[model samples]
Target: MDLDCFKAYDIRGKVPEQLNPELAERIGRSYVEVTGARKVIVGYDIRLSSPEIAAALSEGLRTAGANVFDIGQCGTEQVYFATSHFGMDGGIMVTASHNPKDYNGMKMVGPDARPISSTNGLLAIREGCREPLGNARQPGELFQIDAMKPYIEHLLGYIDIDTLTPLNIVVNPGNGGAGEVIDALEPYLPFEFHRVHHTPDGNFPNGVPNPLLPENRTPTSMAVTASNAAMGIAWDGDFDRCFFFDEKGRFIEGYYIVGLLADQFLRKTGGGKVIHDPRLTWNTRELVQEAGGEPIESKTGHAFIKERMRDEDAIYGGEMSAHHYFRDFAYCDSGMIPWLLVAERLCQSGVSLSSLIDARIETFPASGEINRTVKDPEHILQGIERRYLEEALSVTHTDGLSMEFQRWRFNLRMSNTEPVIRLNVESRGDIELMKSFTRSLLDDIEELDGQSLRDPQLSVAL
Candidate 1:
């Protein structure tokens, strides 16, 4: 009865101990009981324990009188796509998403593919699992579905295929679920793909498929240079987030990609609201404004971004963490759409990815996201705020403490699940200024760490 798997956003934990087929089945039933979903879409990733867990979950769904559409072995987004594409009542994806091989978990969404987080019915579902429900009057049926075709077609609709010219592109799925998708889209596209670790392996031969790590990015970067590909793209285990590399084999920061995507989406939508996170703003805001699109800032995280997108009717939303949301795709983030749009832009503009991103990087130099482990994250956050609040031109608490000044800005936010605080600093086209402030902030954080230990009573309201 260990329900530690239930998280702020989704369920994720060590397998068998924290999560297993039994709990998964109970969760499936609980999902139906909480949401009253009569027709549910069930999908799983390429994890070793996924098939058995998914089958058990489907059984639980059936027991709860909810019919199950099993889209076997797909990415997390596929569940989102299948759920909304076929108008299912809800969907659940059995995936830990870049977690260790020994771990397994689930991501759930209610009607219209809206996420079922703790703020919604996730906690209620967790509670429901504690007390099992009796068998329903009638068990529901199970249907195996091939959502690949319609899903791929829907993805292709984002960009004009006719406009895409033959270009050499490097794609590294890192032995995750994205290779299957790339293979499916191969016949319809004009690009010559240099696929690295293209096979979908539950063992994750190349690693856990998290391209965000500096070590995991090496293979993709090398492949881009070795093959002289136009650009390189790498995805996480579930492929909900995708990281990019330029022709020169350099990893492009996700913040820059956010701006690039905002501009691209705005051009297509002919001036629509584009939502971005608060961490890095100058580049995205400037690009969005230049493209005649309204740039709206939302608190970081997929749920927050999607909800804001729904509220504002945004054409697109992006995070510096690599999740890109689209209005056409039911306000869900897609790993496929972002890359395709970038490739299309490359083809149309006849420019290298580096050329496009370099300009933006120069216009807005950022320190990227730097994480620091501290004794007291809250105290450090408050200490930093106290030091900077007096002269700050503007202060925002959308997600974290974001203080903006005349020439620079920084966001110091604590991690939800860890004792680490993440800091992001940026300047108006001044790399030295950005670097100087980043170092200064790091020093302040280091000093605050000691100060907090000495004076625990030093409290400042957020």
Candidate 2:
């Protein structure tokens, strides 16, 4: 087995070769051993290999003296729902998320659906997978359950049914796992959904199920425009994150969605704490403050955001990558809840989605996220820090290097999941300044790699 498959946040690697059934079973046993979980929840995405891997994991957990609550073929968040809502000791979702077809992985959570990442317990699980396991006193049980009804009920609880208005919306699951939930919730919602690539086909006829990619978004955008949709929502393979599009078929950055959602929650609760990732914070922070809510910054990633949310009792947390967390939902990120809340807010406010966040988008113009490949990402980061140290108001190494100046700020960080370094820049109401900073950062990155860093098409003007 390839030990390298064990990642810091979750286990994702090429299927069979790196994450075969045997290895998956071993991980299941290791999880039970490490978390001392008496009972666990397990689910799989629509991938062809997922069922076998999940079964192997179930075998591992069952043989290791733990009952397995199997919520068959599901999205990642469904496992979180089953684990926390049913009060399971732990949970596992066999999914590769938005990764390519060849890849498959698992995301785990402990009691209360809290993330079991590197700093918490994933490292221990990795080590435990290397050790031999003795036979258990008695094999545990496995139970099959349908989680959709309760899951849909819980999602609907986030919004008032009476407040919903009829609106045409486009939903693009990209033939992943979200279609199931959307179909389940259709009967209860007022919005007219225009679905594209809605089937749960593992073959991914339209391409990999990642809506974050520019190419993957075109179909959704076109469908929204054709259908005259008020908005559009797209999800990755395992449906852990959801992306948004506006009435004009324009893809809205998650940075602004974070701000919009923060305002929605703050207005309801009459002021509460909100958590947001550091990658794009100005809009969220400003909106939070304006809404009489406390803004808390957390390191990027679902694990960091969820833990921080629980600690701060944050009503909601958002990341620009599209992962959104709710305190009432066990402080776990959900792809389904975010769109639902946004839909409700849009319905109640009776304003175009574009109008809601347009001003904020203009006020704190961002470069979105620009990625660059480099031989050594750390060296470039160090170079940036040294160059900007004297001219900054402050510098933070929360998740990456965040340097703040009077009129502009930027965060340049190496991606944990990929070799590329990601840069996000925003200015205080200066679109030209944000663009200029983005260009300079890209040039510096290109100089380091001796190749053009900016991919013209991937770069978006906010």
lDDT of candidate 2 over 1-462, digit per residue (tens): 467888989999898789999998899899988899988999999988999999999999998999999999999889999998899999999999888888899999999898899998999999888999875799889999888899999998988999899999999999998998999999998879998999999888999998888998899999988999999999999888999999998999989998998998888899999999888788899999999999998998887888889889899999998888888889888899889888998898889988987898889999999888676677677777877789999999998899999999999999886678999999999999999988988887776555224432222210
Candidate closest to the true structure, highest lDDT: 1
Candidate 2: list runs displaced more than 4 Å: 417-419, 447-462
Instruction: Quote the positional error of residue 458 for candidate 2 in Å.
Output: 32
Cα-based TM-score, every candidate: 0.99, 0.94
Assess candidate 2 and give its TM-score to the true structure. 0.94
Candidate 1 structure quality by residue, lDDT tens digits, 1-462: 899999999999887899998999899889999999999999999999999999999999999999999999999999999999999999999999999998999999988999999999999999999995988999999999999999999999999988989999999988989999999999999999999999989898778889888999999999999999999999999999999999999999999999999999888888999999999899999999999999999999999999999999999999999999999999999999999999999999999999999998999999999999998899888888888999999998998899999999998898998999999999998999999989999999999888777777764433
Clashes of each: 0, 0
| Candidate 1: residue pairs that collide | none
Task: Give me the candidate number with maximum TM-score.
Answer: 1
Model 1 segments more than 4 A misplaced: 460-462
**Residue 387 error for model 2, in Å?**
2.5
lDDT scores for all predictions?
0.93, 0.89
